[model samples]
Target chain A: MSEQEFTIEALKQILLESAGADENIDLDGDILDTDFEALGYESLALLETGGRIEREYGISLDDDIFTDHRTPRALVAAVNACIKDTVTA
Target chain B: MSARTVITGIGVATPNGLGVDGFWAATRVGKNAIGRVTHFDPTPYPSQLAGEISDFVAEDLLPSRLLPQTDRMTRLALVAADCAFKDAGIQPGDIPEFDMGVVTASTAGGFEFGQNELKKLWSQGSEYVSAYQSFAWFYAVNSGQISIRNGMRGPSGVVVSDHAGGLDAIAQARRQIRKGSKLIFSGGFDATDLHLGLGRSDRRGRLSTSSDPDRAYLPFDAAADGYVPGEGGALITLEDEQTARERGAQNIYGEIAGYGSTFDPKPGTGREPGLRRAIEVALADAGVEADQVDVVFADAAGTPQLDREEADASSAVFGPSGVPVTAPKTMTGRLYSGAAPVYVVSAVLAIREGLIPPTTNVELSPEYAIDLVTGQPRPAPVRTALVLARSYGGFNSAVVVRAAD
Candidate 1:
């Protein structure tokens, strides 16, 4: 599938698979510092999103970018960087 | 009533095997459970090998009423707890609910459940996802579900110190027992058996990608780079000495003689000072000196630096005198929260059997100098055993187990 075919829903799927959440999650969702229950997250949920994005998208986010990327919108931007890198490579 | 706690029975559903008989047989012979992921299509993933508890059938373990509400981790706990209660000869209805409490550890909560729901929502939309999906993926999900299912009315809690929380939960159990309680169920189980948790660790570059199964989890080895994530559950029934004797249900795996825990301000230097301190505290708590420790169960984390920290802390406590140390977990990938109880079980068996299983795949090391067991298991008359664990996030727990006298 082309990069254009990957919608925000597709991106959400990638996020959900990689780190463990969905587009229904607050793009401004505080997945790192906040109580996941208040944010409606439980049981190894975030890991699904984190795993998929790193493996499928080829994004090597190993340097503690979690501090700045507190929200899903910020996470999306970071993910886009990985997408950019993958497209360029 | 002398508040001494003993593991009356143990039930395990781990990557190594399904039940206690299977688990013990696999572990005693030193079998490796690492393999490519089969539960999901892991073809596109970075790390191919993991210690997956793929053999477990949940409905086989959980109560019919509670099965619908429990997570995979909870299912593992319920099954193990049942085995433990039965192993101790404690029937479900026979035990007093008010006297029993559960202290457990969890790292992932319900990643799989959440992932499945998200899949339905992403593919068929939110309408396809079940409303009960809300309860399946939270950290407290397992503890609450297990307690309600088993009718455990004592203290119920879940520790969150990464994987170290597993061992730490047991430490709290010991404390509660010491402070005054009848029977305590203390153990932990974690399942990140999903792409999300796996992705996070992979993105953080924390897991081993070496395709070779046997060579994947080389704990304390020089080339040991990272751990391969895994899942499983272990539980034990701890009863007060008098209470156990009065009921005639005391096989006594061992006593939770002493327990200690500490936190390092930052992940800097070998957490030796803090770990050494915890060791000292546990030894004192158990009323035993360092030399009396016959065998040491090292949390050979399969991460180079962490392993070194553990080795140094141990050497400082035991003082260079080769106190036979073993990390049987090399056979299974580090279960994090699942590691401590599993190690404790091995320690209990080591005390019972007078043998320390070998540390699998330890070719060499970079700094720490505690005699690393390699190739095969070592037989020794272990009177006392120490299980030391340190978490990557924050938490160091030490438990001392003595030969049941």
Candidate 2:
């Protein structure tokens, strides 16, 4: 799979696993537009997700990544961009 | 007047089990979780065996945000606290922000994390140090992080009285609830089997070097030599009776009926008065007679001398061969600051299920003449339990828990 696809899949799996308490949000829905808060993820959960992504991909994310990308789709895109920039450099 | 404090919910991340149900099930059947150390290569250490929680995956347990900033110890604490809050049916947003509190006990705060950071600093450079290096090992970090994560804004504190602090944390929770806090998260946990932590245990000369898992921690046994290091912790929700009633909190485990603590500075004697006195005081505080206690959850220090002291103390308080005694720590090993709360959990389970969990990895030592429940679970009406704990460095504590009314 392409890096983007992998990132998207990874993000979805992480959300699906962590978002057990919230029954309102559909896990199969478009993750890009889904607000994580609506899915029962507060700041702590989001930060933990970011940390896992950083460790798995071997990348250091900007501290403000949560502010920059509030949804899983945006987070995956940002991560893919980070990997691309690192590879190109 | 102090409010009546009762344990409304319990959560545990033990080597034997991850939650209260699993933990109780394993304890009920006398399942031991000790094994060859997998957290690190055990070849260099004196003890090759430990009660390690190898199956816990932090990312799967906690939020992604907490993964980088916390250590295994804190992760265990947070997960246990989360379970406890769910068990209590409490939502921080639903209650008054200042009505809840968090109190935890710890002997070594994030020792594994601190050890790695220090290695990086020495082997690489100052620049290699992680930003979390400073806060990771602070003993109070567990209480602080739990409060922050749950947005609990009431009184918070951490007890550092070695393993004995586990019982003390619960005592403090009752005190807090009496002082007007509606609910308090109380108990203790530790993950200190890293090289640094292990080296300290090695220097103390109390860790069992036995590579065999079954023989690793034989508390109250004739062959008992020393304890094997264990990791994990327990956290329970203690709520004021009125608050629990008001919130419609069902599933009450038991009440923190009474507590007492004493210290013994002189270490050489095989007999100690402090443990006995603590038990006596605790029973008196609860207004219960010695014969009324259904079972005594021993400290089960596993050292030959310490085990003798604990047995003698029980004998002194409850008469010879008194009130079915058990030490389920033989199953989970001693988890330092996490030990007593886990014992408290076992006692509560015994009370709830009316069966005393057996003491595994032990042959009744003829030396102490104590009637230890072993081999299999003993069925009896368990109404009250007295849990005991003693720190290696002289702190002795006892807490009395009774079936919730």
Candidate 3:
């Protein structure tokens, strides 16, 4: 089976499922550059999302991913990089 | 004089009903909510009946985000807190954040959540467990979740004295109010069914094993067995009386006049149980004479030995049948840490309406001289009510609630 690629759409789904979207913020809009905090996702929410990603994708993620990937764009890219490393290695 | 602590709002989630109005209505009419445990299969257990809030769907009442992080108990507590805040007609932002606090009680913490996580750990490995389990399984999570949700940052805590913890937590909130906090959300809730199995094996020997709901938990009855376990409780919005009046609080339920707690001496010591002392101290603290107490809300453990002890204590303190005693918990079962606060709610409501709710399904044995109010709701001038609770490990607590002037 082919591996699923980590994308902004995937991250959006995970964010919504893990933390739920803020009523005031539109998750479908250009939220790639929006900070998770601005999107109403806090550290605990990010931790849950990261845990879900690791379990689903068979990859381990560092806790600092929450701090380093503050936006959906950065988190998607970081997750895709980890997936690629797992596939190649 | 010290500032008086009064309950301004009440939110309830009980087996018989939800919210203050629904619960009080069912309680006053002596409705029984105990039935076969449907939360899970009870066919294998000896004790099949419990007071379950079968219709409560947390997802329907709470935000989706909270659904992922909280256990059923915490969800119930959060919802109760929301109802209390709304009932009080005061928003968290209306008061200074630092002026509000949360003090709650928990006996089992979030056992169902912890049990689920443990199952995941054993079957799918520890990595499969949800990170939310970290806080969800904690006893203090109810207080923490309520605090975070309402921005109550002044002082927060969870009392864990089992059944007595409910009144203990409210008393702690009273202390915070005395210390100048304007608003405090206090009370407790429990949704743990882990002990049902123990009750089956007679390990605790404190659960009713009858299949028939009507005869299952007959406290003070000649055929009394033991208590049917239950879930749900209440969150009371307690405010400094002066502050509540100044803020134009629409309803002031009653003043939490006095509190006293004591631990039972070792069983083999032959020392008297501390329940009587607790009641006396509470009356002294409230400066109320024993004869002045209009009604007594009993712990009603439902076991013969414990029932006799409670009856003896009440008779000794109030003189034989001197005060009208009731245990509306007969309708809801013993809710562990949640029991006392609900009784407190009943007391406050009784004070307001001057109608004492009845102890349903219980036939007081003539051997006990206490005047147990049963069969029908008693109409009387209830100006002051005393609530009593005793925990499994011999913790006893008493609180005196009086009508606000």
Candidate 4:
């Protein structure tokens, strides 16, 4: 698999593992902007999501992720950037 | 007037076993809770053994909605809290959210979560990092998670006073009750996994590298080196006396009769005048003479200097006589914030069952001889137990637990 594909698959796996979302979480869909409850999760879900992604991808994130990436779309962007950086790193 | 507080419920997750029943049973038989580290590969790490509660799976406790957000320690907190609430005869929904509080402690929370995030950031690009990583492993996650889960709207606080935080959290809860809070779900939880933050500091010679469980935590013996760190602490539902009576809960385990805490002034100082003061204050608060304490629950930090300081303080208090001393922690290593509550729980059982579990690995030598209970367990009717604890670096705490009829 290309690094990009690996990154996408990895992010999906992380989302699936953490959120327990079986269906592919559409990175482009507005599902990105929903609160965890709306996305069917407790608020702590996002932290776990970020945690799982950091572990599998091997990255350190800034503190803002907790407050900055509120929407699903914002979260997707965050994940995408982490995945890209890890691939390059 | 200070309200009298009683422990109506207890929740425990530890290496000895899961839940209060298993934990109490294991210690009753003087069973060892130590084993080879499996949470992470230990092939290259200098330390080989730890009192690990790595068996817990979050799926078992969290609701489908909250599963993703609960960290391992928080997950354990939920389990223990549920168990304790049930034991106290109080359902989560039964209590008015505003009337209840949770005082939880963690030396570090979400450590595994943080470590993983950092790993991803270093090996992968910075873009790979997740912001949730920030709070996943902060020091306050335990209390935060408990409050969120139980919907407790009362006062909540976290303590980083090292391992002693467990007992101190309980002491803090009792203080809260005195100040008019109706209930408190209080305790501590910590996890030191295989990730980078997990074993690095301990492996840096902070942890005893002994492979044998029995020999690994010989607290107070002349050969003491260091303590092995472990996870899965305990919490109890502490309520004021009038409240417990109103609820008709009669099986009160014990009373949070008294607590004392003092700092050693500076880290790594052999001076422990502060430790002595803490003990004196706790005893004074309890209104009990030093000799009146049936047995002394020691804060046996396997560090040689700390052990000596504890022995000297204890000896000075009781005059080195027959006030039998035991540190059941030796069998399970040190659980940091998890240790004291587990010990306090064990002390309650000892009072109820009429047996004092022995300290596992000790063949006492001249340097430290305060009647260390070792090799075999002892039978004694304990009416009151003075539990002592000192945190890593330098926090000291003592609490008095008395038999509840």
Candidate 3, B1-405: lDDT as tens digits:
788999999999999999989999999889999888888887777787888897788878887778878888999999999999999998889989999999999998988888888889999998878888889999999999999988999988999999999999999999999988889999999987654333432577788889888888888899898888889999999999989999899989999999999999999898889999999999999999999999999999988888998999998899999999999999878898999999999998998888999998888899898999998999999999999999988999999999998
lDDT of 3 at B195: 46
Candidate of highest DockQ: 3
Could you tell me which 10 consecutive residues in candidate 3 chain B have the lowest summed lDDT?
B193-202
The list of candidate 4 runs beyond 4 A from truth reads A1-16, A21-39, A42-89, B193-199, B266-272
lDDT head-to-head 1 vs 2, winner: 2
**CAPRI grade, predicted model 2:** incorrect
Instruction: State in Å the error of residue B369, model 4.
Output: 3.5
**What is the docking quality class of candidate 1?**
incorrect
The window of 10 residues in a row where model 4 chain B has the poorest summed lDDT is B61-70
Q: What's the lDDT for all of these models?
A: 0.74, 0.84, 0.90, 0.76
lDDT of 1 by residue, B255-298 (tens): 88888888866645643347888888899989999889988888
Segments of candidate 2 deviating more than 4 angstroms: A1-89, B267-272
DockQ of each: 0.02, 0.07, 0.57, 0.17
CA error at residue B341 for candidate 4, angstroms: 1.4
Candidate 4 lDDT, B276-329, residue by residue in tens = 788888998888788888888888888787788888888888887458889888
In candidate 3 the C-alpha lDDT for residue B392 amounts to 84
